[model samples]
Target: MTEGDGNGFDTMSRRPPSRSIIEAVAEAEGVPAHELRPPTYESLHTVIDPDALDALFEPHADGTVRPAGRVTFPYCGYTVTVDADGSVSLE
Candidate 1:
């Protein structure tokens, strides 16, 4: 996923993960096997600022904020959403 700043700069970018890959990583990370699920795409415009979207993709950028298009750990059955303007939210 990618989002551009108002001035046309790509402020945020993320790579989608295959279902198998996500499951494997989650298992290796000690996330509950029964709790894992594929991530779903969602629009973030309703929740956050566009310029901050890029930060979500950055590893450990903020423990409190999750990146769009990413699945949460421990099988919460939720995915992050990133809007075109770079805002982020969970769906």
Candidate 2:
């Protein structure tokens, strides 16, 4: 994904929202996603189900787009927001 608007967020992405969220959060933490592990940080699964998050914004079973919307939740002290347009923001 490209850089965001100078804030702690990311520009729109073509990747799955779940992947975007992990990458963005890791970027904010100044580490790679693989490094966002136990002892220092918490597991993403401790906060939310990654698979379910991906499904929420994925296209329908028939390949139709889901309605425009967003899902927000708390993870690792940041407010994670995933937009239907594939933008993810950490606040």
Mind giving the per-residue lDDT tens digits that candidate 1 earns over 27-89? 444575445434432223233342344444445635443434442322223343334333333
Kindly list the per-residue Cα lDDT of model 2 for residues 1-91, writing each as its tens digit: 3334435576578788878888888888889899887878877888889999888899889988787988888887788888887889887
TM-score of 2: 0.82
CA-lDDT, candidates in order: 0.35, 0.81
Error of 1 at 31 (Å): 28
The count of residue-pair clashes in candidate 2 stands at 0
**Which sections of candidate 1 miss by over 4 Å?**
1-43, 59-91
TM-scores of the candidates in the order shown: 0.19, 0.82
RMSD of 2: 3.3
